[model samples]
Each structure stands twice: as structure tokens, then as C-alpha cells.
Target: MSLKILDQLSQDFTQLLENSYDYNVVIEVGKQPNIKLYKAHSAILYQRSLYFRQKLTNATKKNNVIEFKIPNLSVQTFDIIIRYIYSGIVSLENFEAATIFDLLIDLNEFQFIELVERIQAYLLIIMLLGFHPSMIFNSDDFKTLQENAFIALLKQDDLQMEESEIWDKVILWGKARTPDLPSNLEVWTDENFKSLKATLQHCLPHIRYFQIPSEDVLKKIKPYHNILEKNIWDDILAKYLAPNVPIASLILPPRKKATVQLPSRKASIITPSSSIITLEHIAELSSWIDRRSKIYNTTEIPYEFKLLLRGSRDGFTVLKIDSTNEILGGYNLLIWKVPNGKYSERATTADSFIFSLKNRNQSILSRVKDESTAIVYGKISQGPIFGNGLGMGRRSKSISKEWYSSETVYEKPIRNIDAWFFIDEYEVFQICKI
Candidate 1:
């Protein structure tokens, strides 16, 4: 028999990740205040993942160091994945089920196909042992699960549920996650259906449409036909009318029956880290930043908001929630000038904007039109002033309609009618490329 030394090899490789002295890549992970910087070598990263290889190929280096920022990923998850990249050893027993599921999705994004498959297999084994899909999908926390994690669950072949019932759960979950959808489907607009489709783009493909009963398809799936691709929906109908004829759509195989009965356990929910806004808001703001007509999905945001200041922590306010629950704020792309013996100074930038996040689905964005006086930096005591559109008085922190108007220096007013309001709390974030 041949001698086995894989254990020692794995241990040595793990040591390299922990104690390497000459690492060149500095990866910044997590949001501010709880962030971590991981020192990694480019060689190991480039060799391990095609995703990292492409990133490294395009990345510019300063001081012989290449930098990467991953703001959306949790520090704990990144730590586990990065170690596995070097050592090829991952122990999943210590992680929560939700965390492991999220790790699988993150691995898929990193182009770690082999690792993803392994993780998915492990999930299947654990799920078969006791944790049933009924427990997971029915739990209160189901809606809070990551999109990728939910999609991964749908890809399983041994799930113990009727195909029609699975379709209902998918629709329910999509409705819960998608914002601003009307409760009554009859009143839904074309845009509303399109939004839900985008939210469930990856998810819809995994449904076993061929296995669903025809009566259920007529009653349940027909109403949401707008969300399905034209060919997929057409093929679904064609299959029933003309069974002998071949259809264009790929019909997924029916799910296999589980041999053992599964016990139930509550699913874990990963709460968002931000206090001010949700992920949907972040996705919308990121689209505005890039000047895109189509908003980015929550899963696809490319920038990270690093906490620069918080009224609760830093003792200052740049954003204020009024008594009427309106969120008002301004963003400046230029630096604040340190007034040189002057009461105030003006700076110019076309990227500056003032905003009103009216609600979850509605927002107002006003970009700088007159760059000559885009922003004004007053004395250190006074807060930010956005070219007469939005302003606050010194020391007292009082807001007045006289100082706020949208007639000049901006595209349009964030607020329709200016009125005095009190500042409850505010926060400032530095947007960094991810």
C-alpha cells in the first residue's frame, strides 16, 4: 500500500496562509468599524481561482501591492473561504447552516466550481439526515435567506415536496423579497412583473416545470406568465397541447424521493448590518452613482459604503430624518476646504447631488447643474451646505426654508416645498469601489 501524507500537506499549506511574511495582496473585507484586512499572496490567489486571476490581471498595483475590497461579504465567511483557498481543508461542523449555505454561494461566484459542488453535496447530506425543506421554507426566517442560498436549495433533487407546492413557495418567497409589488395581481403593471422577474432570474430556471401537474400549471403558473421568458412559457403550453412534438425549452427532470424521513429545525436568518437603509436602497443608490438607467440588483452591487461618520457614534449629522419620516441628505464628490481666514469657501463638482429618500420605492435625486458653485464649506462648526439647495445653521443645527431652495446650482429640488424640520439622526458613508 502507498503511504498517505495528504494530512501533513494540508497542514503545511494552512500554515502558509496564517504565517506568510511576504504577501503582496491586501484584501479589505466587511463594512467599516468591523472590517478586516487579509494579507494574501498573489500567486496563491491567482492559481486557486479563475475569478481572482482575472481580477489580478486587471488590477493596478501600488508599492508592489494589489488591493481588493469586498464590502458585502462578512469577515467570518471570507476568513473561512480564504483559508480553504490555501489549504484545501474546510471544516463545516462549526458553522451555522445559513453561514455554510452563504459560503457555497460565495464560492460559486469566485469560480470555485469544485468547492461549490462539494459544499452542495455536504448540504444535501445534512439536510437528508434531519433538516427538511418544509422546516426551512415554512420558517419565519425563510424570506431573510440569501438569494443564492435559496437558489441552491431549489437545485436539490431529493427535496420532499410536490412540484406544484414548490412552485407556490418560490412565488411566495419572490413576492416577499421584491419591493413595491401590489398585493392584487390583477392591478400589476408590466414593470412590476419585470421587477419580480429580475429578482428571481436565477431561481426560475431551477423549477421542474415539466413535472408540475397540468391543472396546477393552468391555475397557478399561468397568472405569472409575464415573469417567464416567452419561449419557456410557450413551450410549457405546447407540451400539454402536443405531447408527441418536441419543444424548445429544456424540461428539468422530476425530483427524486428521499429514502428517509427528515426532522424539522428552524432556519437561521442573517440580518442586514446597516441601520439606516436596506440592501434595496443601497442597490438603487449604486445605480444612480454609475448613471445607469437600469438599477442594479441587490446581489450585484459593485460599490461598498464605508461608514465615515455617524451621529450616534461620531457626534455629527449630515443626513436627517424629519418628524414626518422623510430622509434628506446631500453627497459631495469634492473635498471640504479648510477655510483660510474666510467664513466660507465654495468648491465645484458636477458629481455632487442632494437627495430625498421618500420611501422604499420612491426617491428624488438632484445633480449639480451649475458647477461654478456646487458646494459651500463653511466654518468647522457649520454642517454641509449644498449650493443653496440644502443647508443647516451653525451651532443650533436649525433648518429653515430660507436657506434651502432648489432654484439654483442643481438640476432640480430634492424636496418640492421647503419647510423647517428638526434633525433626529444622520450618518455619512464613503463609497469605495468593490
Candidate 2:
């Protein structure tokens, strides 16, 4: 068909809808003077909107003009739906995120299944490609999504936003339900806490409270302490005071490193798919452990490890098993090989810390806790290096293979690794606020 013929058909059909010559139903949408009265054809309305079909099918009014009282729907969105019904076009221009969101919900209510799917795909593509998250996730103007929907989005491993920013948005969403919330929560009475808590009950459980730093917790969570349960606060303190927590207390999975734009963290065997603990972590730890060593500064990776790196040879190894939800990686921080009582090129550093974590009851796999009282700490000069605990209380044979591998041997000082592996699955992490 030519463009002119299609245009003429669209115009004729549109005029037929607009003229309302055979109109039998009056959709009395909205209320008061601002209310809209769309004079629509009963046959065409039934053909387009399933909702109209169903309602008109059950109509019992004696008068020729039947009225539908839909007070919840905005007249603007309704008008767009009407336009689509007549012209098969859903013009999305001049509409804010909030409006589009509202339209999505309204379409579902009207049983516009095809349009609903289209809108969902558009929003998903926009979010996945890293377009606008504010329109959908914002708290102030974000009124369209249901509680379950918002919670599901927050739980996304690759949600593209700063963890801190997510926290702020969540708070904004909670405050919406509790209008009386005060800016200064310090003065919030008991009633205020209750209101906020009720609003955020589902949201609180999903927050990765442990990932937030202790200082940030005090700054952000402190004011809302009234909303948190007492046991949560106690656990937060324990993690910070003693980082090498034997069992994981953090309930939520650590926010997966999302975008490369966010800040970096220490290299562990496991990290968000988008990230790996590059040499920067090792260099930082090295600088902290021994100020005498020159910081490693080169894009050239002198060493790379996939499965295992011999700890005695400055071997850097990282392995994360998704099947087991296990993550463990170690740096042979101060590897000094003395074959003939002569040290080879050593990867010496001031810091040596090994960390691990799992999806469930967090088990820590690290060195002994009190180095002074420990055997290796007293015998070795570079002692008290790795993480805490009385030698991660328990371990696994597979995960602890790095600690004491004789495949390559180092000097006597490097022989301080004591507690090795035990079971197939072990866990450990600094149960700290940060």
C-alpha cells in the first residue's frame, strides 16, 4: 500500500472514532471539573479494550449512554490508550518517567497485554544498556512500582548504581509511606520509628548492611537506628571489632561489583563478574606491609593466576566456584625463595591478608587470630600477616591448598602457614561494617 492510502485510512478511522456519531458509552474518567468524557462506540470500545468489553457486556443501565467511573486512572494516560485504539500508535513523547510508569500500570489494568509487554521490554533495555535508572528507581516521583517489584530490582546482582546511592533511594521510598518522618531522626519519637519500620519491613531485609562502612553506618543507619532491630546493631559492632569472623553474619549477598566506573576493592579469589582484584590491591597491601619496597606500577602483568599461584613464589592465585558459592584467593605477599640460602626475586609487602566467603553461613578461612600467642607468629619475622581467628576455626582440603604447597618451597621464614584445609566447603570474611 502507498503512504497516501495508509494515511487516508488512518485519518478516516481516527475521524470515525472522534466523531462518535454512533457513540453509546460515556467513559466518565476522573472527577470534578477536570474529569474527561470520552464519547466512544460500544462496538469499537469492546474491540479495543478488553476491560470495556467486559464492563459493557455486564452493563445493566437502562439509558443508551453508559458511564464508567474510573477515578484511579489519570485522564492523560487514558487519552493515550484511546489514541492507540484508534490509530495503533502509542506516542511516548513529552512523557516523564513517572507518566510512562503510570501508563504501564494502567495498560495492565485495562488488559492491554501486548502494550504492557512492549513497555516492559523498553524499560528493561534502557536499564540494561545503562540509560536512566533514576526515573524507575527514584523514591520521590517513583510511585508506579509495587513493593515486590522494587524489592526484586534492588536484589539484582548487577544493579547499576553505587551501593550508597541505592541506600539513599531506598530511604526515600520508605519515607513515602511515612509522611511524618522528620529530617532529624535523632529527635524521632518512638512513633516515628514504628511508622518507618512498617513501611520498610520488606526492604530492610534485602539491604547488604555489612557492605556499608562502619563510619557510613553511623552516619546513615544511626539516625534510623530506631527502625533497625537491636540484634542487627550488635552484629555490626562485632564484625568491625573482629573482622576475621568465623561464620558469616551478613544475610544478604554482597552487592556484586556492577560497573567499572565504581571504586575498586581488594583482590580476592571471587569478585563481581565485571571485576578482578588487579595488581593495585597487591601493591597497596605491599606498600602497607613494607614501606621499603617500591610500589608495583606497570600495566605489564609479570604474573597471572587462574586456578592456583604457588604462595612461596609470589604466586597470585584466585578461584571462585559458582556451583559451590565459594570464593577464596591468597597473595603470597612476601614470597622469598631461598634455594641455596639465597633469596630470589621476592614479592615482599607490608600486608598479607587472605579472605574468603560463601552464599550461606559465612565460614572464614584465614590465619590464626592472636599472632603473639601463635607458634608461627613468634618464630617468623614477617608474622601476624594474614587474617584473624584462632586459625579459621575450621577449613577444607580443597580451598586450603594454597597455604602449604611443597610443589615449590621458600625460605624457613615463609613456613609459618599453620592451619590448612579440612572440608570441601569453608567460609570466612571480615565481618566488619565496611
Candidate 3:
């Protein structure tokens, strides 16, 4: 069966001992109800039986041997210990007893700290775990026992004691009678404040401060509020502060502005040949223009052309010719190499030649108007000049010269004109004379 049931059975037997004045009571052994009692006191026998049962139950629970209180104790104390053994119940009776303090010490000695812890936990549940002066002042033996327990707890090296436990003991000790605590005192003294502050420093985060202190009490402590500067106190306040105002806002100093420096300008020269452009030289220029036409408001130059002169690596000295035929200075015309084998040459006055033709007779001009039409044509006498040709005999044919006299009735149709040609090897040919 379960350990709880076994504990219940042991508790029933212990209860029987506590309620009976003598251990002479009979027990049924199988069907026989009147077995002669053993020489041992029935209470002792019952105690031994309960101890073995508790031992077996504790073994099953993976706990140390169960501790049983000495017999013939007060009924309340007996009940508490018996209930604890039987049902793992934490009984509230004799919680204020000095004997209960010794029992807890003995329980700890037996490695049954769980039971002691449970008792303390139950006291805490009932709000009776805190130190109360009235409870301790009435019993000096209890106070001494409590003080001894506190000393033992303080000396423990392996318990890994909790801060709450320490604070509880501190409260207990603070409530106990001592020469330091005056009988007529109506308020806590400096020594009390010191002890409270030390204990609170360890358990501040766990304590519910708002529940204990009134506004007036808090105001009284304001002058001594330097204790709140401790790390533990700050941490507790930070955790419990209202969300609207941060804890740092209440405790930390205000922030200050910092100054920053701007970078200084430096002078540097950039040559026309240098690829890196400088901002200073650009700012000093009298005029700035960009020729990129595709972008709506962009000023970058778009068209590309080359300088006519050879060995012209100097971009600064190169001239620019605008659409208005005006020459501008500065920055070269950048040219890109035409793709494939196609080639183009620039037209200049040096490479061009001019020629002129004149009509002499006014009557011939009037008679040409009578024809109602005039056809004027000319031919090159030399081989193809502007472009490559297969052979000299395959040159373009010449044209005829004719005029309709009636077509020129309004005015004189013949006038002298000049024809310009940039000829390399081409010669002129006359097919008709007018």
C-alpha cells in the first residue's frame, strides 16, 4: 500500500498511546482478541511499532528515518508529532512552545529537516511564523530555546538556508526578551533598526513592505532612508515600482548633454589631368554647365567628340564647339571609339575647296521660263572620290542641262551660283552647253 496509508496506521497507534493512561490495552492477533500483553509497556511497544512503520514508510518515500517525539508529552504536542508521523500533517498546536523548538532541533538532528521545514511553512501559512513580542515575552524558556535554535541555524554549514528562513528567525529573535530590549519601550530603538536593516537587506525582495507600514510610519523613516541605497533595496523597489514611473527616474541623477565637433575644411589643388575632383576648386569656378539632355534637369554633358589635333592628351587646353558655332574653353570633348571597321573624319576649312557657276544671258533666262520646266545636272569626270570604288570605268554618269522658257516667265531664272566641294581626285564633266 501507499506510504501515506502506512503513516496513517502508525499515527492511529500513536494516538492510541497518547489517549490511554496505560499500555495494557489488548490487540487482536489474527482472530484472537485477548493476547497477553508483552513485558514492555504498551505505550513503548506501540511507540516501537509506530517507529518501524514510519521507518518503512520513510524508506519508501526516499526520506531519512522518521523522528518520533518522546512519549508522555503534553497532549497537544503529542498530537502534533503523532499527526506529523501518521499523515505528514503539519499541526499548529504548541507552535509557541519552547519544547516544540527542541523537537524541531531533534528532528533536524535525525535528518528529518523536511518535517521542520514543513512546520515552518505551515506556520508561515497561518501568519504565525513572524516574530511577535507578545508571544515570546510571556515565556522565557521558549525565548531561550528560540535563541538556541537561531544559533544552531546560524552555525549550519550545509543547509543552504533560504533568506526567508533567516528573516523569519531574525523576526523571532527580535521579538524575544533580552536586556537590550527595554520593558517600557513603545518604539523600536537604533539597535532594532540596525538588526532589521541587516535582515531586510537579505530578504528585501521577498518582503511585502506596503502591507506592514503606514504612510505615517514611512514618513518617520524618511530621515533614516539611506538604507534604501543598498543594492538589495534598490532591486526590490525597482521590481515593485509602478509601471508609469521608472525606478531609475526616482533614484538616478538627471542626464546631461554632450558636445560634438564638426570636421574642418582643408585646401588641396587638383590638376586637369587628375581623376579626383576637389570641392574647393569646383566652388571657385565662375561658370558651370552640364550638357546631358536626356534627364529633365540634369547638367551632365552627353555628347562625345574628339579634338582635331594629334598628341592632344591635355584635356584642359582643348576647345569645345557649341551648337551656336561659338567656341568655349576648358574641359575636352571626350570621344568613344566607333565600333566595327567604320570610320568618320572631321570637316575643316583646310580640307575643303570652293567652286562657282554663272548664267550670262537674260534672254536665255526668259526663254528658259517659257518651257515651264528646267532640269540642271552635272557629273564628275574623275573616278569615285568620296567613297571606295570597284574600278575607274564604273564612275557615276553625267546629267543634261535643259530649261522650259514658259516656266520662267515670272522672273529671270539664270543666275550665277557657287558650288563647294572637298575633292580628293574627282574632276568635273559638262554634258550640255546652254
Q: What is the lDDT of candidate 1?
A: 0.73
Which is the better candidate, 1 or 2, if ranked by lDDT? Answer: 1
Best by lDDT: 1
lDDT (Cα, tens digit) per residue for candidate 3, span 1-434: 65446666767655655564444333221112322221113334345344434443433211322223232233444444444543445543424433444345334333455676654443332222122223433355544543334333333222232333343444545445334544443465777656545644532333333322334224433433443456535543444464344444233221211111122222132122212212222222111223212221112212112112111121011111223221111221222121221223221111111111111111111111222211111121121111110012212221111111111222332223212222112112111111
| Deviation from truth (RMSD, Å), model 1 | 21.2
Please give the clash total of every predicted structure, in order: 0, 16, 15
lDDT of 1 by residue, 86-122 (tens): 8887777555565775676567667787777767656
RMSD of each: 21.2, 24.5, 46.9
User: Which segments of candidate 1 are over 4 A away from where they belong?
Assistant: 1-80, 83-131, 260-434
Candidates sorted on lDDT, descending: 1, 2, 3
Q: Write the candidate numbers in order of decreasing TM-score.
A: 1, 2, 3
Candidate 3: C-alpha RMSD after superposition? 46.9
**TM of each candidate vs. truth:** 0.37, 0.34, 0.19
What are the runs in model 3 whose C-alpha is more than 4 Å off?
Answer: 1-196, 199-204, 210-214, 223-229, 232-243, 248-434
Better of 1 and 3 by lDDT: 1
The residue-by-residue lDDT of candidate 2 on 184-303, one tens digit each, is 866888998898889989888777777777888877777777777788877776777786774345556665553332222332322222123334543333332333345434232222
